[model samples]
Target chain A: MKSKPTACFLLTVVLSCVLVAEGNRDVNQEDRTIEWWTLSTGAGEHDPRTDLNRLIAGEFHEQHPHVNIEITPLHVEDFKKRIQIVVQADSPPDLFQSWGGYVMFEFARQNKLRDITYFVNSTLSKLISRESLAVYSYAGKFYGAPYDMGAVVVWYNRKIFEHAGVPVPQTWQDLLYAVRRIKDAGYVPIAMGGKDRWPAHFWWVYLAMRLGGKEAFDTAYGGTGSFTDPAFIQAGRLFKDLVATGPFQEGFENATYDQQAGLMGDGIAAMELMGQWAPSVAKNNATTGKGLPHLDVFPFPSVEGGKGDINDVMGGGNGYIVGKNAPDETLEFLEYFLSEGVQRRLIEDQGIIPVNKAAARGQTGPIATITGLITKATYYQLYYDQYFPFSVGEALNDASLLLLTGEYTPEETAAAINAAWREFK
Target chain B: MENIKTLYSVKKLGLILLLIGPAFALFTTFVVMPVFQGAYYSLFDWKGIGPLNDFVGVKNFVRLFGHEPFRTAIVNNLKVVLFSLLFQLPTAFFFALLIGRQKFPGAIVFRSFYFFPYVLTEIIAGVIWRFIYNPQFGFLTQLSGLIGPEKTEIAMLGNPETAFNAIFVVIFWKYIGFHMILYIAGLQGVPKDLEDAAVIDGASPLEVIWHVIIPSIRNTIMISVFLSVIGSFNVFDIVWAMGQGGPDHSTETLVTYLYNFGYKRFAFGYGSAVAIVIFFLCLVFNVLYQKYIVGDSRS
Candidate 1:
């Protein structure tokens, strides 16, 4: 009888201890763990960006000793596909890398993303540029924050241009003349990666922007106009005219972006229509290990009868979005991650064009020029592949390539895009 | 005895169920369920997320048949099939005959050498071939330079007329060894005494091979053909790793078409419709092949 009573008392004590442990664990788990998914900026195991991200996470965890962050780093290409599946499964990471535009809008529409407007207004709004911030906003609500904003500009090798005896073009006709001069000098005038499709489509999108500006896109996106607008068709026609010049390197249609960058880096091609990252990519892919010593940037020249201003820019930025079930600390973490000091460090280390206003002051060379153009832009248009609905954007890429290959006329290309737009819309 | 028989039968029933239950369940879950689910999704206009509310009803299918890229994809798949049947299989058979029963010097080494490509993963093989086909710094460019000073390079994969053929070359190189191995196995099974008897009875080597060896390997050839046809239609990874179905949708097979148009574009409904179409194509071919070929041979 005495033994039974002793056993019951011991059981009660052990059970209470277990319950208390469980209670503490629940509270700690709720406050502590955060899951983050990101794309590595370089190859696996050797990526410095992955180390930087981990260091940032480590520092943030040190500041808040109760928190633990689990980071999942994936390759750039695989990240896009994996995130989509995870988002669809309703269990997305607390935060993941995003290229802010229609992809974010799609997620926002499905309520897969958390609205961070309050956090943005309180902290991020003052630190980051409104133009850059707008990239992460959808339906009048902010869903994320940007770290890097870059414009697509014409990057040219100064030596190549000098050899060809052609000055930097200020008009479309001048560019065409330079192309011919460069070609005559026995070098590829342009290095185009048509196999990827997006690089080639940039030509059409920039042309469309030059021809019609923001109004045309707005009207078409607003459903009052169609993609078969004269401006879009004319853009295709202009691109075809450029294609007919045979300015791009031989087999350019099958070249990847890396191959295109290699040609420019090796001085085999005189110019490439690329973004701020082009120089770095060229340096990495170049045969000499160091690309062209003297590089220059020029804005896309104005067309003869175009309504759009030459100052209007086409670009995008890399950012991170908060998942629907993310903890409130995710916002705090983002703020810390994009702090002025961190942004400067990123710019100094990684050659990223910082979106932070204070960090933007430190940019030099081609990056500074791109930053200036973006800041002074009368309008900023994101890449069409990211700006429009997925189907329409893909159709634009496909049709644009078809137009380049002489398989489809400008009218037929416009018709294809418009047909896809109608279906998706 | 009757009671014992009933007990044994009950035990047998339990054992059979126990053995087959897991496999049956797995097949139903992974294979059968997805087919039915894909068919169901084909009726709706879903972007692969949220509720499937947009019930368009045969609209995706109607649009798929009318879509230009899809038609191009079908033609490309047929081209692959034709190439494999006409070129790949015959080459594989010829090589198999040369080395199958013969004990030539380096025959073992040659067998391993030919089968080396078959052992490589498709993606790796595709990447290797891509480097070879590259115009700027590729082997072909150097070869062309050596041949002519001005004719510096040839971009076989860049041209629409040649991209699919380039991919076909890789496919043929990768899979011909597998078919050759199959033929070798069939040849090994052919009774050596039958060939000897034929030769002794005044039949020539070619006549003996035609009469004795070919008839014995008919079943293996039939299976290889069926596999090759299905494989041709389903090729995606190689083409994707090389060009992703373009310079301008020039190298698109049905599977790549389904991926680029449906999944990449986020039109899951249309993608599911494409999946159904592919399934039906395979099913029809399988049924026809089995009925006319395998079944006839068996009878």
Candidate 2:
């Protein structure tokens, strides 16, 4: 909240005051309590997304009567840290948000999570596709289900592009040229939240996908190859060229992701690279509570002579997992929360790319574009941080940051990630 | 008489143990034991929650020494200590002379003004200063933007080169007042007749300060220096609140380095190793400083 505008706090107060529907909530009639921790669109109590979450929890509580779901919405980073502490202490909240990857698997390996494989097989499988739930599965046991899945793409302000006379870029070279034009037009070409490192990793990871395709990553992870392979190093060099352009906002290296969202929401910068949730976050961070009027997204551009197709996707999703100590009612609440109605609400209001296929039937424009890419993709890669242990993921973010800051050469950046992989593995 | 003498020696031993035994045991268990415990833990490759079976002896230390950020943390910590001593000395002395020597109009007001930042919590001071150093619409940037080159933002904490200096400035501002207050109190202990006699002997004001005030406050200055050095090694909240030892680990002190690499990465073994390193550094400094600079004149 350093340098955070006062209006967001005031607005949160106003929004939090906005009452839920009368039918949504009632005092719980039972003794059992569930702690439901979630990753919020904004940090702390200054969240816009939590209203919808609170509404869902309240509705769930009303119907259940015996099981009270106490919602704790945390910012993404805070959520990770808090959950890590709780999980390590072996007193995980009844249920908590999970991105469904090595982190969740780590929890499962430590026997900290409740195995919901039987539930997934009998009940949830019919609703959420098996492939989507595969993320939350470890060694053939399902622990959670994905409610939203999408790809990282370039979110841009059309007004800025038009003002700069720049066309939508279709290739890496075009993107670079567009950045220069947009910068020359006196707008920050890229609104990077560099302090939050992961945002910058998307640049390198996506480049690696487009350059080396999925094979490089698979081989590297399988120990047949290494992250220091040519494609990974090449990704670093390309990312370095983009950083050399100086397209981000002033003081970008220390700016939080929220600040980046605010910049996009305010249309103070031309572009940001983010997932499906970008628009809602930008709106929440915006001065006007309505983000860029001309917000549009384009797929990450392909590099020339790259082995990967343009449709090869780099993405992940948001979901929930149950603690081992969770009451029997926790699954019922999670299932209800992931039911079509709530998923639809999440999609419509929060710009979520819904996991429930029925809920995503008619998304038009930018969202459909993302959904289509994921559906038709030759490869779909989870975020490196999510795919690997948290430490390796952090090292990847750090190494990418080094490349972005010109602190590490491409080969060195590649070596750093590889070293962490070997060490942590 | 021999039997009485034996009883007296035994009684003396009993009295000595009664005075020092509990404290020694407590110190060994709480203070001294944890350092050795940390040293033991540092030998294993353990995450925070797991078993300590992976006995990678001294591997953590080897990695720590090879880690660039830890080296940076050491340098940054030393710089903090040096800056506090070098910058605080003159400012605290000047203020002590200005306000403590002679009370004038609004002298109390000036003292309060000088001491105000110290009263504010370190985190609050850091956060407030972070806003002041904010890259875009910050007070400093906005003001400088008016006179500086157009479209060139001078981001103090964002640039790796300038971030440490920016943090140092904040640290200096936050603690200088405390040191000044110490000096002021020290100034009060200076004998008035000694100063007047020196003046009567035709000593200049500078000479009087050098000969009288400086020597008189030596003990206070020693305590302040010790605190400053130890506090520098322990500085975490301010640097962390401001930068998290970032803009590419440019502002990392030893403690933040310990936190980021050890706890954050969930590599508690490496973190304990870092703690041991910091412990030894502090220990070495404590022994040398006490034995040499603070010798014999403790009273």
Candidate 3:
């Protein structure tokens, strides 16, 4: 009996010591650490973006000596998959990259994100554009902030256009004419990456935007209409028409995005409908290492008699969302990171279109062209995959690709999308 | 004496249990538990995240059977199975017989060369093959160019009809060595005396192989068939790494279908349903095989 009492007392003492050690660890953790998960901007050994990130981080550390910031950089696809697992495990990094739209909305809906609406409306509101900020917003509440926003545009090889004797297309008919001329000139008109289905979907989505503009999308997405709307079907039909012209390179259906970039960079293909990252990717993938001597941007041409203005754009942006349990300093760091000076540095060096209104001043060349389109746009729509639920987004990509292959008619494609929406909505 | 023998047997049983306990525990925790959990999850309309409150019952299964892509996936898996039995196994067996026990100069080099592909990871093999299949700038194009300039560009993977066949060729190439090695090991067990007796009886080489060698190695053949069939059903990494079961989902296997529909779309419930279907398919095949082949042979 005495031994039992003595053992109980010793057990309590040991347990209390263990508890105290754990308590100390918890306090130590709270005092001085933040984890940031970001996508690596470059694939090679000498990446200036990584250097810039470190420079900014060093500056931040100097400002806040007590807090230590740890950045874990991952490749884009790896980051996406890892982040999903991390978020599901309920131990997301303090700050992490997000491509704002339905995916972010899903995270927000699940209460996995920290609501930064207060910070957005108070201090950072004046710094970034509302339109750019809207990408990261969900249900009228801000969950993240965009640092880089860009529009999809036609990236053309100037030499190829001159060789074919075709001017830059300003209308759908003109674009079709250019395609015919380019093909007749013994070159593939467009370098498309159909194996990675998102590139192909861009064609259909852009057509939908050109045909119907914001109202058609709004009506369909707002539950007042259906995805099988005439405008959407017409978009599919137009995409099929483009596919029928044999615009894409040989084996394009199996070619990856890198391969498509290679084709454009090598001047084997005339044009590619891609984002701002096209030039850099093409340059990296080119046989010459220097890519095209003359590369230029043109907007996706307007459809004849369409409701959409030619200036309306289809695009999205990269941003960082705060995790649910992130420290207050995470938001502070984001604000510092997105300041005008930092944004300008990123723009000048990284070739990204600035989300900061003040930093938008010195933009030139292709970046300037995209910035101008964003500013003059009548309506800015996010990519369909980003804007819609995951299932519906996947269905859209599948349906669009099928339509491109002539495997599914426009009507059938529309029905497939509508059916997926019904099931998953 | 009887009491001493009983005690000794008890000790033997204790030793056996002790040896197996840790592995059994691990397998139960990791494999068996997850399999059961997956089955349970198949009953709900749950995303991978959050609580499992939405009980969907058999709706996921019903939907899977009705899905066109799933049907395509099933057919693709069957094609793989058929091809493996018809082409892959026979090729491996033929090679095994050719040099399995033969001691010639550079025989070891030949064996290693044949086994080289099996040593390469599935993803690496897929990537290498993708480059080889590239229409514009690949070895295939160069080879075709030798034949004629007009034949230089051929996109076998781009065509839906040929995509699955191309993947099948890679599968056959990568796994043939493994099956060949299995057959070689089985051949080593065949008694030389039995072959000599068949030869002495004026039997031809083919007859000797059919009557004596094949009967002796039937167990190994059965096991290799079992492994090949299971492997065909679970072929995901190669297909995924190559085309992501694309060019219009033509290369989709059952596992790839499960991944694309379930994990990619966050439809965990539906994915679990797919898992259950795959499990049952493998289970039914294994049970029937064991009963008809292994059990019958043993008896």
What are the DockQ scores of the candidates, in order?
Answer: 0.56, 0.45, 0.50
Of the candidates shown, which would achieve the greatest DockQ relative to the real structure?
A: 1
Worst 10 residues of 3 chain A by lDDT: A41-50
Better by TM-score, candidate 3 or 2: 3
Which ten contiguous residues of candidate 1 chain A have the minimum total lDDT?
A25-34
Looking at model 3, give its docking quality level: medium
Local accuracy of candidate 3 as per-residue lDDT tens digits, B1-299: 99999999999999999999899999999999999999999999987777899998999999999988899999999999999999999999999998898888887787788889999999999999999999898877888878885665879888788999999999999999999999999999999999999999999999998999999999999999999999999999899988898888888889999988898888899999999999999999999999998899999
Off by over 4 Å in 3: A1-32, A41-48, A85-91, B1-10, B149-152
Which TM-score values does chain B get in all models? Answer: 0.96, 0.91, 0.95
Error of model 3, residue B200, in angstroms = 2.8
Could you tell me the interface RMSD of model 3?
Answer: 1.2
Model 2, position B74, has a per-residue lDDT of 93
**Tens-place lDDT digits, model 3, residues A216-325:** 88988877988789899999888888888889987887889999999888989899999988998999899988867688999999999888889999988788999999
The collision pairs in model 1 are none
Q: What lDDT tens digits, residue by residue, belong to model 2 across residues A1-425?
A: 65466878877777766633222443233457999898776745657679888888899878877777788888887887888788888899988888887888889999999999999998898887776788789999988888888889999999999999999999999999999999999899999877778998899999999999989999999899999999999999898889889889888888778889999999989999999988888998888888666899999999999988999888898888889999878888888988889988887777788777777678797888888877777687888888998678878988877788889999999999999999888
Name the lDDT value of residue A278 in candidate 2: 89
What's the C-alpha lDDT at position A133 in model 3? 87
